[model samples]
Target: MQPLILHIPHASTHIPFKDGYLVGEELLQQEINKLTDWYTDDLFDSPEDITIKADFSRIFCDVERFVDDQQEVMAQYGMGMLYTHTDAGQRMREVNPTLRKQIKEEYYLPHHQKLEVAVKKQLDQFGHALMVDCHSFTDIPFERDLNKKVPRPDINIGTDPFHTSQTLQDLTLEFFTSRGFSVGLNWPYSGTMVPMAYYQKNRQVQSILIEVNRKLYLDAVTCTRNRHFNEIKSVLNQYLHLIRSNVNDIFYPINNES
Candidate 1:
């Protein structure tokens, strides 16, 4: 069986360049604090799993967004692949065509390239790849969020119709629910990450998004790890193992000749 690929896209806080940003250091840090998927790189860590993480902060470039603004829904809110505005609708960056292109070349494209290469290697070796798009979300809804309803679930599983199978979905729900987590299916966020090369075209490239509610392991106010951080990480490690052991059953089930 192939090792699981963990796609961690928003855990970094590094701002590569400040050329286009309109916000001051203090304000930018505040946004970073709120937007960054704190400790996700560590939260989803597993010994045997392959991880492709974005080195720059999402404030610099969001690897998760679609390259074209026309295809991204969040583009309407100024939070596309390269965010120009903050969650509160304030203009945070002046993204001219040249700057946009530069940022894409400098940050966005390279990250996706890494993802594509990783997935390709897996497919070449095992004929299939399962990418777990790891993420964490704030318990409180953001100003630009599609869902503003209070009291969000502890765990949210985002699925792709073409890439996420029925069996995969059921197994995911069972895994978290059995652990006593309040799970939601695409409640606050929806959709999983797949490389453009394989998206909708390759059934062998399966993907799912696991968004943990930050309240479970983060101190929202201070943006620090809470007492439950290690506990949460332990659970995620178990989840990785669960996927590994059941890889064949989930992706390539055997059919008995009846």
Candidate 2:
């Protein structure tokens, strides 16, 4: 089995249950349309890699946010684990303690458990694991986005100081830049996903976040694939193949010692 875990967190638009929502169905749908990372699951799909995707929409519960609001930077804007406000700072949901706890138990915890299990399985089998946190961001900045820079790069590579080796970083840059795509190193968004169990504790479990610009593959307004979609998908597939082929060289001394 490949020692890779693909984490696609915000791809779904399904809302299992609707409670505490302040907006009507029409408004809620609009928010979902705006926030959902459309087609990311399909874009990052790889039969060889283990994929852990959230079944529900991020508007319901964002698994990426830190469980505790205090630890999450976005929480201050009311866009934490359970979003209470929309990108425009509009009240979207009424998240009381009970509802927060319920969502945590129902959605947040279970999703994380799956990630932990996948990482552990890879480590046990291969002595090293690589997590590719796959995501696509809007070319236009959201109202609440910290960075307001226009003309975003084609790709954003998020990394952790310890988990992302210099070699891996260089290879990722080369892979994208060589194809004539502009790249950003932790620019608009930052940080790769690591299961809490091994986060900052294990170097063998490596991770890198690949955020593709929506303009590259989608018509952002319509939320549909554009002319470049297929070409972008093909390029991403090649990227996955590149990483898999160089797994040994990327992991290096760890595999050597093993």
Candidate 3:
């Protein structure tokens, strides 16, 4: 059966300009400048794939479109442009955490809810499903990027690794390392983004979070997709195959759904 994989495209904080939203902004040149120096150059100065730039461009465009306004979109981040005169922006800054939580529930809860429906539908036909939640983070946190970005790590494979079986954890670590990734065991982000969000409904639903460092795929400042991205994707394919073969042996399903 084809696995039910749901990749969550990153939703970053919106930057509110005093004027308002910048519609249909082209960001390729901005990315080209920011990406030329950092991790991309360090890993692969020259890569064979031509499609890598396209991926970055797509993400750049979509982010602008997704959060189309200041008041509404900035709320997604519990932040706003500096407005010393206005209470709304200051209020947004003050209750940021609470607002952020609410936004997560608003945005992510629906995603999970939809996923539960979709996975269950797939299960009705296939009897089981596998979900690999895909994400990318930075090697280090970007604290003051004009473009607000949550800090990330080189690699984080979150699967409730401590709570679950050791064999599965080992397989995941070894498999990813073998597939050409510098791996980590939840140093930056823990298991909640994985099993807790999408796979929380039941153990029958096997879930693994693949947190790739943004450095692995793109430029930090420009939001450019790295030349090496295609290589990473290729390696991931092989790793996924290994997981598919060993699902029965490795995944210990938590069948009890709350």
Candidate 4:
């Protein structure tokens, strides 16, 4: 068991649309800059053996969402499995059922399948898997964001009632706060990622979403890492160490002394 599986769903600016459904290249780049979790993948680095990253941008296909619209809440906002609107609540492109289905099959399903495989492999070997859902948000919330009015903290830890363990949650909060980060629990964003099959059924599949606010380490205007980039990454490395060291204590008490 690798003990940790980092699930980085965003951070790619590559939008592979050769047809040019978007109005202009400038608009596309604006949307990408606004929506992409810029430099988050680098910030959330760790020595985890299992990592499932989506190389394609979320604007193309959001793998974290439920494939079925009825089950996905973000579908109402036109930002479900396949985005129908931009972050500013404007039309990005028209996605018909056929296109939606194609995107789902091509990008969405494959990323999730990889995640499922990684998680199951860990569970089979160690009887437990700790999934760290990595993400980052802008300091200013987008127009389409549900919690636009809420002031997001420097570090937001999203958790699911079913899959997030209390011990892991406590350690996570402590780790970030001790480093002088203002932490929020599911404020700007809620819901942690768990493979749909084991989502509500398996308690051994522990998961947590660590959302770092971009203002801390990213130059929002230029879409680049600031001087604080390495500082934040170093702190995250320490945080990972803490979580890894206590894996036995938190998830496998029987092997605490082993």
lDDT of candidate 4?
0.83
Q: Clashing residue pairs, candidate 3?
A: 137-214, 203-254, 217-226
The residue-level lDDT of candidate 4 at 150 comes to: 59
How far does residue 219 in candidate 4 sit from its true spot (Å)?
A: 0.5
Model 2 residue 200 lDDT score: 84
Pick by lDDT: which candidate is best? 1
TM-score (C-alpha) between model 2 and the true structure:
0.96
**Candidate 1, residue 192: lDDT:** 96
RMSD of each: 2.0, 1.5, 9.5, 2.6
Worst 10 residues of 2 by lDDT: 249-258
Q: List candidate 1 segments past 4 Å from native.
A: 253-258
lDDT of 2 by residue, 27-135 (tens): 8888898889889998888888889999999999999999999999999898899888888888988888998899899899999999999998888888789999999
Task: Give the per-residue lDDT of model 4 (tens digit) for 119-227.
Answer: 8888898888888899999889888787875567999899998787778889999988888899989888888999987988888888899999999999988998999
Q: For model 1, what is the C-alpha lDDT against the true structure? A: 0.91
Model 4: lowest-lDDT 10 consecutive positions: 249-258
TM-score of each: 0.97, 0.96, 0.55, 0.94
User: Candidate 3 residues 1-258, lDDT tens each?
Assistant: 254344443332232221222222334233223222223222322232111111222112221122323533433433222211111222212323444355435543454456566567656765555665555555654332233333443567876643334556788898877755667676565552333433344555566666777777775665656687787666666666666676566544433222
Local distance difference test scores for all models: 0.91, 0.89, 0.46, 0.83
